[model samples]
Target: MSRPKPNETSSGFESPRTDEPLFQPSSEVWYKDGNTILIAGDEGFRVYAGMLSEQSSVFADMLEIPLPAPQATHEGCPLVWISDSAVEMRYLLKSMLDPRYILKINQTLDLPALCSILRLSTKYNVVHIRRRAIEALQHYFPTTLSAYYNARERRRLSSGGVSTYFLLANTCREANANVLLPSILYSCSAQQLDTILDGVPDSHQGRVELSHKNKSAVIQSRHQLAHLARTGTLRWLYSGEGCSDKRCVAIRRRVGARLLEGRSIDGFVNPLSTFNDALVELIDGDCCEACQNAVERCVDNGREEVWKKVPSVFGLGSWDVLVKAYGQE
Candidate 1:
């Protein structure tokens, strides 16, 4: 696939002084082959289609050179390098001519951090050349990486959940929860939820939807599931975050306070889309405190603004209103 196209201007890089080397900046460019096009650094990172220019950018960093951000991106985005060598890395960080390139240092140069770039490519909406570059980076990791480098699965059978908490969630949901509850809550097939929920704490009331009750499991899981909610997965199982099930509800309840205020349903997310695609668009478009709170419930951790928005949006209203607004999906 062709690299993603970035808007370009003649002057790509910013100016320089005696201390800085004089390097000419080029606009984003692309070269097309029969059906495919490749974007090179000379043309910025832009391609015929939306492909990321990561390879060229990272390579430029590798060559002790810098690539200016094209006109297409937000100005605040940092201009970072990936050099691991202290001399090279330090010089590269200090050599940054663009003040806009904040974070002056490279975060990852080791195998693990470099490999994470692959995951970042998958997470961010980068495509084409950028995606290809990420795929190539994966080659840096050995086919048989060490235990940590290739720990593909977080919840292993050998180490899945807290024994006590697992028992609790099992017991809580199975007994009181409809055998059909997981399906209703997970947005997954009945069998999937059933299989997962089946690991209940021997004959507890039902799935331990409440957060406090399942503390052991969270500990056992090493917060991996919660991390999935925050970063790994986009499709949150429930109709929304809190309403997904008891565990989700408890997570939010436990967070205890609102981090952001106003109709700003701004919560923490890598892309921020997993939680509030609607919050930023809908709430930002226009939302009352109540609607904001209700929307705030989308966060998995159940932040304070979210709780406040929930009650304000629904709790303040009649039972029907509350049901419609805050009722579990």
Candidate 2:
């Protein structure tokens, strides 16, 4: 079917008058013989109400509202006004109607497309798109350090680096995805201070900005991470019962020397990875079995302890509160 040219109103009346209002349709592709026209801002889209209603309870409810005298029409279809970003609505509509544009697990969506789907899907209560968006984000920012390391490594191998965690942070809030925030905020905190302000390309939603509270929280996380590097880690490594043994003492000395030489945690965004690296170094050294086991235990304990504090580090509530907010409870 050929695309419908822009008509000024729901009536589809072509007026030769100079006063004919400016009208924009989404694209040639979406202008199907679809029964309903969705007008977002100045851009109109011809699409199926039945398909939208099936996917979204919100749309079903909206469609249930009785239509009065209709002014705008395209190919005998009524034009419905949508108070949303035209770009976002376009993306959402495409994701629903176009098989090729549909979101999938293995396929990567650039930040703009992902953000649009997330924003509109959340607002319109489109569950599938929202789920896919959250899954894609989780792939980028997994909750556990091991998972995060695996995902981060995969991302690095495939696309390089993720510099849009800050943008994801806001989108998570918009989408009621608090579960993703702990990882998102941590990733954002890990970014270089300058880059945090500049933001990554394609993640900008209107303005690429962080809340003042979040900015301070990131700064605090850096400071706390530094403190953990200097004292907390070293203290944990040396304050051991096995230290009485000469072999254990030698192991501690070797690890401590490495730490002092800057196997430091100053640059680590996730404390678990930092601790894991330290454990690996200790294991490589000629440490006694007892000391090695003790160090490993310390790493496990420290990881749990740090994870519990992660939410607070980013100015959020305790873990329990955050998990409940994310509807995990």
Residue range 149-176, candidate 1, lDDT tens digits: 2332321222223333233233323332
- The segments of candidate 2 whose C-alpha lies over 4 angstroms from its true place after superposition are 1-31, 39-44, 57-73, 78-87, 98-112, 155-162, 197-207, 225-234, 237-270, 274-293, 318-329
What are the clash counts of all predictions, listed in order? 31, 7
Q: Candidate 1 regions off by >4 Å?
A: 1-108, 112-274, 300-329
Highest lDDT among the candidates is held by which one?
A: 2
Q: lDDT for every model? A: 0.29, 0.66
Cα distance off (Å), candidate 1, residue 13: 63
How much is 307 displaced in model 2, in angstroms?
Answer: 2.0
